[model samples]
Target: MLSALQLHSRGWRVSVFDSGSAGRESSWAGGGILSPILPWNYPEAVWQLSRRSLPLYDALAPELAEATGVDPELTASGAMLLDPDQIQAGAAWCAAAGLAAPEIDAILQTRGPSLPGLLLPWIGQIRNPRLGQALRLRLRQLGIALHENTPVTGWLRDGGRVAGVDTAAGEHRGDCVVLAAGAWSGALGALPVAPVRGQMLLLRAAPGRLKRIVLDGGRYLIPRRDGRILVGSTVESAGFDKRVTGAAREELLAFAVGLLGTEAAGQVETQWSGLRPGSADGIPYIGEHPALPGLWVNTGHYRNGLVMAPASAELLADLMEGKPTQLDAAAYRLGAGRL
Candidate 1:
């Protein structure tokens, strides 16, 4: 949506396509964790992107809220990681990567409080459903064409250049085509993307269950302003089956229960799943095809699609406009995995 807004603002006619309702996929389902709760594990480029994007939330959130009449609730609530081993490794990686490691408050130990958690002081989060709602409303205000419930069957190309897409209704022609189709991105004819499913459970937080986001190994407990503490995200290669299974739910429950005290575990309200586009490499595919002409891609964000959305739009729009990009957008190209 930010990409569409950026491009449309540049006087380009932009159109977005989605199989379900717009922004109903992983983009909407995410817990909106920005920056590394364990940022040290990933490459420095991702952190750099968040550093650029994290500031924009303040400006973008209010502007989007005013324009769309929906506040995305972009909050600067920090994240806590309870892995001492990962923290040590993360500090070493930060120094090796030529980045500054955030200061740690080691004195905050409270009579050996459960376990000493490393606090990522610069992280941010957004309410994803609200972000999606606001993005859609903003796009509508801009007169950008939104083709929801319209799945692209294939790409229509002529002489190596992409002309448009072959959809269920008809072909929509464009001088330049940008595929921001989220998780279903790879399977679109020549695009080499596979859908990865994630099962997440949403629980209403009891009073003061958790103040900040808690990362305990595989399970993350994200608390929202409206009292919905989202416990998520099981990474399974179930091939686009966006259905929550009993096994996955039970696993999340067990993990979450271990993290929280006895009473907080009982407040788990609902469970659901959302599919994310995953590549063999965990990095997202976000550049133009090497061979295809007049075409671009912005998919394969893994689970960070929501967090990366704002920055991606700015970068992609810069590429489309033939202007200088902030990051080396070409780094995220579809190399051997070209569809």
Candidate 2:
């Protein structure tokens, strides 16, 4: 959808094909944290894409709301790193990225003395479901054809270059075809993309009970404006099985209450799972296919699909249009060797 929007904005007659409802995958099930969980841990390339995409989301949400009349609820509610040991590394990463350093959360430390945290005031979030709705609406307004439940079975090959895509409905030919099919990208061919399942639970808490997104250990809790707090997630190599296991639910519920205290324990509203598009080397394939002409991929984002989608789409569109990209595109190519 991000790539479609970007291409459409650039005057491309765009058509989006999805096997299921838009955003029902990781995009819908994600906690919607804009920044990476830990910025210092990823490759420099990942950080570069994230740094570029993070700020774009701040404006993109409102712009969509104005254009599509669906408020995505993009919130600069900030985030907290609930571990003192990570402060130095997080600060260093922020400094290297030219972002303001995270501050010591003295108040959280005062309350939870065992786990001191750092405050990153610039981190933001979006309500994923609402964002998905807004994107669909915006695409409709732009006259872009969205073939929901229309699975692209394969590619429409021409003599030398290429034609477009083949779907269950029929051939939806275009100037270019982008395979942003998320975890399902592998179904078309051996694209080195697989599904990594993540389980999450939601807690119904009082509004304003939790102000900022909180991360501790490997778990996170995202507070919504409507008093729904999302606690997640377990990264498992569970293929495409999006089943919410009981063990995961129990563990996440305990983790949430452990951080927010037992008063918010029994308010567990819902639990679900999503399959992230895991790549071979943990980086997305975002360039033109080496073997197939007029074909491109923008998947393998894993957990950072929401974090990296904006800039990924921008970069993919730039490559498609033969425009100079904002960042080097060499690192995200599809095939092994280069030209």
The 0-to-1 C-alpha lDDT of every candidate, in the order given, reads 0.76, 0.85
Please provide TM-scores, in order, for all candidate models, with all chains considered together: 0.91, 0.95
Count: clashes, candidate 1: 3
Best by lDDT: 2
Error of model 1, residue 132, in angstroms: 0.5
- Residue ranges of candidate 2 with Cα displaced over 4 Å: 102-107, 337-339
- Candidate 2 has a TM-score of 0.95
The RMSD (Cα, Å) of candidate 2 is: 1.8
Tell me the deviation in Å of residue 298 in model 2.
0.8
lDDT of 2 at 174: 76
